[model samples]
Target: MSSTFETVAGIMSETADIPRETITPESHAIEDLGIDSLAFLDIAFAVDKAFGIKLPLEQWTQDVNEGKVPAEEYFVVKNLVSRIDALVAAKGA
Candidate 1:
């Protein structure tokens, strides 16, 4: 797993009460892990703190609301890992 995946899995484990062992790239935050909206917010906060990068929360929500991206895609572990990798690379660059 990538470091981004590890970080996200750790955050999910803590915030969503899901076991790290069960967290895979295909895991769905809500369907597989039972993460509710409130828990998702907490996970987002934790991710921001851990990575020292601010997630584009407003943009993500707006995109979903505007039908740009499926709302469920936001909670996919692989998608989150990819996003985090992009953010980290952009920050470094």
Candidate 2:
């Protein structure tokens, strides 16, 4: 995995208190990680800080409340991973 992926996963694991192993690119933040609103906020905050992306809190809340978890996770994690990858690339570039 790239350092960006490792860093994202590591922060996610620490913030959500989920095992890093369980937080694959396919792991659903709500279903697989079992994260609630606060937990999701925590993850978003951590991700923002870790990747230098200023994710808006209000937008995040709206997304979570509307069940639009960044990637709309259901059975796969590819969408979420792609979002993260885009964020990481933007930050790095």
Winner by TM-score: 1
The reply for model 1, stretches above 4 Å from the true place, is: none
- Model 1 is weakest, by summed lDDT over 10 consecutive residues, at 71-80
- Candidate lDDT (C-alpha), each: 0.87, 0.67
**What tens digits encode model 2's per-residue C-alpha lDDT throughout 12-40?**
78987888888777676677778777876
TM-score of 1: 0.88
TM-score each candidate: 0.88, 0.67
- lDDT (Cα) of model 2: 0.67
Q: Which stretches of candidate 2 lie over 4 Å from their true place?
A: 56-78, 88-93
All candidates: CA RMSD (Å): 1.4, 3.6
* Cand. 1 Cα-lDDT: 0.87
Q: Report residue 91 deviation for candidate 1 (angstroms).
A: 1.0
lDDT of 1 by residue, 12-79 (tens): 99788888899999998888889887888899899998888888877887998899998667878999
